[model samples]
Target chain A: MGVGPSTKETSLHHFRDPLVDIVGSDSGIDLMGVLVFGSPEGNEEKIRCSRTAAVVAECCRPDGVIVETDGWGNLDVDYVNCVNEIGERGIPVAGLNWSGTAGTFVVDSPYLDNVVDFNKNPEGIESNIVGENNYTADDVRECVKRLKIAMLKKGMNK
Target chain B: MGVQEIDLRRLVIKSFHMTDVQMGDENKITMDGKLTIDGSYVKDLAERHSKVIEKIDIQIIQPGDHDRYTNTIMDIIPISTKVLGKCGEGITHTVTGVYVMPTGVDVDGEQAHEFGSSEGNLKDMLYLNRAGTPSDTDIIISFDITFKKGMGQERHAIIEAYHAVDEWIQVYREQMKKFNGNKATEKHEYHDVIRPGQKKVLIIKEMIAHGAMLDTWIFPNEPSGVAGGKSLIDYGCMPVMLTPNEFRDGAIHSMN
Candidate 1:
């Protein structure tokens, strides 16, 4: 199958149905969505995407999003807007910008890790988001790990 | 009145074995055991009078073995006193009581080892030192009864004894708290920072017994390769130490 758009439409199509099933329609908590924005800089796209994802995830409710961006420095406006909306709702969002194909970025949450990656070109970006082409699974694991630590630290301080 | 002399009886020493292990690998070793006047005797003596056995003190003596020098540790095993009978003496109530031993006593291995000579046989003498050292020691339970035989009083002395024991336990608990250290009150800080481009690293920190911190890591990203440090003292995590106060307040707001 040909690769599809890594925009808000695609993430919604993939995640919204499952999230609805989990939270239920009348539960009053919506599973907000994630938006991945390509870095304006050439080499820093992965870092930008990761930083944005961390910030967005903190702003949103936990377990609300999976942001995917093609590593080739192209911004997805609609997805960005969805991230903003989720941010407004206080749901957390996380973004993965793959160096190669958008499908390659690792999708991770506190409870989930090493999700399905279908990208073909591993070398297309500075950092491969998942598997061998990227940093080891341990690195990806730390991203979520440190985020949780930060969250807990934030919780205890208050 | 001139001073009168009261003769004191020597408490008989009974044989006992170390039954419990407090720590380390080697388990139960037997030691020379001694018998003190069972605490129940005080209650029995007090029953003839119209008074209660408030407290009793016993001295422990070590009977030395001839073959080897033996050192023995002594522990006071408290026995529970259950209520037996209560009665009225004419117009007043008098309580009568009896005391019994609850369970066997415990002895320690060090005491047992001391009894073992170079020949590997246990020595005969149960040694008593000025220092209060305990062998395998255990608390014993005893009971008391307040009601006497001839009087009309009905409540047993054991009920009052139970109250006394309860008060004693409370006192012991307070003393233990003081000995263990002050209750932990202060908040602690934990920090971890990840630099860019490093991979295959993890950080872990936890609180261990006696409020010690344990930190460990796997595949650390730093070139120095060390991934662990602990807080100097016991502390709870707080917001200001972890995040800017404004950010923490905002985060709390978001969570709410």
Candidate 2:
């Protein structure tokens, strides 16, 4: 929540993209492109980013969607909006974040229930430890697990 | 006759791998994969930034030696230089198996330019062998800078520190330019290609240039270097168009 360095610099080098390994191991799951979004500067920018992300995910035409954000607080406004926008389009979207009890979304939708909190800290709070609450392979697997159920529910709804 | 397309710009990057690093009489790369650096030149390097910098300590941290406590990390810079031609269209010599990390703190024991300082044991604070970090086998050249008591928060203080490190590395860059390209440990060639009657693709990369530590350097004379590069803030954070070959050649130096 209170990182000194830019997220662009810290996030890229501090963690391995688990998506690479997951795609290599599972043939049924064809990995799509990754969409990146930073903390928008203003409310307009936030809404724009959320809509753009949803539009991009729609273009990908996947069976399910997993949206991950490396931030909390005000950033969750766009995070939850992105999920809701995709969900409103009938896409089964799941959110990945470091929701350490206190890291709740500022604006949320019904789709927020499918969120996977990847907090590894014992205290379930933001710490100075770099990469402590980052998304891992286990978290990605859990998101996939929940996403499959959401997709099944959507199929039943249709 | 149909006009044939030719690749006008080609970049060749020659890499040399150094397995071991040590402080010695002079800076030189041996045939046995050992990089010997002259520690005596650090005093002269510190002299370049005497106003804001108090002292500069140059040390080589070997692989798996991450238990040692250190100051806040500023940046991890790759050692690369242009051996022939310009940045994107010519020959570049680079060092693999090693990276230069800059760490800093003020005289009053405050971490420099960091809001949430990562000042604990290195292993516990950093993820090793990531895209921008040192690999498991790579040695780390730690350039620890000590700023003046009240200068840690100033943007120029960190810039001077980086300039000192750049000057120190220029010594090695000059020597690397003279190495034989045939003996390079790795070689990669890239071309800037253009195709007509095809869909256009553009990659929009967003960078932070909100002033202070949130700045980025673009189009340095050397690959991934600070010299001759313009800061994104200096450009008013405008959209700068760059070729793919230029980008792949290390055009963007993230100061953040």
Candidate 3:
């Protein structure tokens, strides 16, 4: 889904796999996901995605949420909207980020509620490389786990 | 094409639920349903398609295994045997919980996927909902097929590379043909039935019918089969109506 590799682009990428990996690796959590595409204004796809996620999030009433995007050019639109839309729901989100580093580190994304680095341990999160892929499956699992904890702490503090 | 009555006979598919997959001295499916792959079988298959495959590395990824993933995936095929007749009209015995797949790059690191190459850690890159990478319930017979450096992007080279590994499944296809259906855990049947009073429905599926990596295979003598199947793209993207049972019984498969 890119518009013929031209000036226009859509967020129909395969980040769902890694997102699935993050949630799927942890045995405790059930990963229900939907890939959202959009236009600048009112697109049916965007409305459906927003509404569907809100409904699921309300129904599941999960501990917390972790959101990330490809963060290159127009891709940031979906990421920002997902975080803010979910955050606007009064649910805490610890956004996972990838930056220029070997290990995980917290970076500034659009949503600042809670941000966790994919490659760095950050401050409170304890993570390490467990595979030839540099970071292990445990890395993804730990990041999500730490995000949930961080969100829980924020919820209590608020 | 005129209005013709397509008679599709018994398209019964059997599934032997695979329990565990291992690479050891023997290359056979045990009575206990464990898949033991002999290293020599891969060598022989590679030799047969020696023109395409420079090196063949066989690896089996089981559920709950950490730090295990595949290289770039080319195709996911189910092991099946044509018991009665040819594809689209036969009793085909197959396994459910296991998949035969090809992964990896050429001798030099190049993208094998024609459109997009998701080559990274297998655990991270593999999406569970897709074929071959089912949740903890299934096992993957991943063949790391590496081609020569320059042969990576060539269409013919890519097809040959895929056919090289498809030969492995062909062996299972032949062997499974002799399988006793009574031992099957499940059986599915397809037929071209007529409903005289009811309105008929014909569903047309436009699939990957090109020389690229994005391709869909239909009625290849097996479910998601490749070896002897015809490419839809080669058929000039023609229209073919299939019975619902044929679709349910594994007449269509994908490689995207």
- Give the top-scoring candidate (DockQ): 2
User: Better model by DockQ, 2 or 3?
Assistant: 2
TM agreement with the true structure for every prediction: 0.18, 0.68, 0.57
Tell me the deviation in Å of residue A4 in model 2.
4.1
Model 1: residue B104 alpha-carbon error in angstroms = 86
Q: Please provide, for model 2 over B1-256, each residue's C-alpha lDDT reduced to its tens digit, 9 standing for 90 to 100.
A: 4233335578888888888899998877753467887777887777768899988888899889888988877777777778888766789888888888888888998887544566678877766655556777888898988989877778887777777888887888888888888888999786665433221222223344434455567777777777898776676444455655566566767655
Please give the range of 10 consecutive residues that has the lowest summed lDDT in model 2 chain A: A6-15
Q: Candidate 2 at residue B233, lDDT?
A: 60
Cα lDDT tens digits, model 3, B1-256, are: 3233334355566678888888878667743477778898888877877776677898777775526645666545566666776554667677767766677577777766654455566665554433224545677677887777767677677777666666666766666767778899887554544323221111112233334454445556555555666665554433343434445445555543
True-contact fraction per candidate equals: 0.00, 0.12, 0.00
* Residue pairs clashing, model 3: A103-A119, A103-A120, A104-A119, A104-A120, A105-A120, B69-B122, B209-B233
- Candidates' chain B TM-scores in the order shown: 0.19, 0.93, 0.84
Higher-DockQ candidate of 1 and 3: 3
Query: What TM-score, to 2 decimals, does candidate 2 have?
Result: 0.68
In model 2, where do residues sit more than 4 Å from their true spots?
A1-158, B1-8, B30-32, B194-200
Return the top candidate by lDDT: 2
Cα lDDT, model 2, residue B181: 88
DockQ scores of all models, one per candidate: 0.01, 0.12, 0.02
Model 2's alpha-carbon lDDT is 0.67
lDDT of 1 by residue, B46-125 (tens): 44434433232222222222243222211112211111111100011100111111111112111111111111111222
